[model samples]
Target: MMTTAVPAPAISVRGLEKSFDDLRVLRGVDLDIERGSIVALLGSNGAGKTTMVRILATLTRPDAGTVMVDGFDVMTDGANVRECISLTGQFAAVDQILTGRENLKLVAKLRHLDDPGGIADEFLARFDLVDAGSRRVAGYSGGMRRRLDIAMSLVGNPPVIFLDEPTTGLDPEARIEVWTMVQELATRGTTVLLTTQYLEEAEKLADRIAILHEGRIVANGTLAELKELLPPAEVEYVEKQPSLEDIFLALVGKNAPEGELR
Candidate 1:
């Protein structure tokens, strides 16, 4: 008889809670992010989204409960947890004085990866930074620098990655680029903890969604599951009194003369 291997969760949080003085930031929250899955954490401002990311990243300690990443306890095995995880913040943290290639090399050295130059070159090509590899990061555009920051965080080849608003300052095209990178990472068996304000982004990227409100997980499940919790999906057809597109055509002049109606 063959014994099956029981895989561990990439991230597990149980009764996690945090508070600053009398104000609770996370109140007995529970979350489980499976290996290779992208779980989106959604919430409004001051909703404790960043707080949960910080706790899982081992940057800040939770006041109660436990957080385990790759089977290592975040509190007791912080170093081990750090080894298994990479965290990227909302703002890009690229070194302004260092060239893009140099930045990658620095991270490689820090992570003790072999052949820092080769690894840097590989990531440069992968992230579309081959042309900017020798350019000082200070001269790089916002999107380019953001890409470099994410690339640097991948130096350790960690099993889990925490992305706090990964596309915060990007244009739509750049945002899609990040989305593609994230999907590729997940496909390659990287577990991602994604925090975002954009519902459409979460809809596109998340295998599961957890909504935080007043520091607690108010809802959790797949997109359809959460939607079910709110209200049943309904289809309503209304008679169009000259739809918005018709008005736009009247004002802008329909250059195509006729367009296919969806």
Candidate 2:
């Protein structure tokens, strides 16, 4: 009899736990992300989202449990894990003094790429930053800086990436730009694990979503599956109302008609 081979997950975690002094951040978390897929880890404030990313990225050691990225154990094979993954934290990590092109070149050089300048120019074009690549990053807009930060992370072309609250503090248009870039990355077969507080962001980008609460994953599934977990929608006498976000956007001209106010 012939048997088929099962591919290894891009990222796998089993019974993961972490603690700092008297505080326990993660409590027996488990996750599995398929190769070339995007997964969103959702959680509220102080819900251990950052801690989980830190452990998986090998920046912090988990007190217990196991984490494997592309079949390499995060704890025992940290160097290999690092080589296969790129991480973009909450804040932009680009140097303020360097131009956008220089920032990308710096990362490429650090990774020992043979043609750092060529790679830098390629990514600048890819991220639509060619116009601003020559200007100092300190003078760039928040969206431009964020784009440069992500471009730098791609210098080595790692197979997997971790984006921790990547769109934080950006205006709506800027956030949409970043979202488009992220979608392009996934389409190119990069496995992405991102932590986000925005439900809309997850709904738009993630193939599957996992919610963390009180240090444990309370729910994990696709958006439709998760919606099934909730009570069925009830019939209402009145028309459904728009969300606060919808109202805010409508009032602030975001959703208003051009040359007219609602």
Report backbone clashes per prediction: 0, 0
In the range 57-91, model 1's lDDT, one tens digit per residue, is: 89999999999999999999999999989999999
- State candidate 1's TM-score: 0.87
Q: What tens-digit string does per-residue lDDT give for candidate 2 at 24-86? A: 999999899998889998877888999999999999999999999999999999999999999
Number of colliding residue pairs in model 2:
0
TM-score for each model: 0.87, 0.89
Model 1: lDDT to the true structure? 0.84
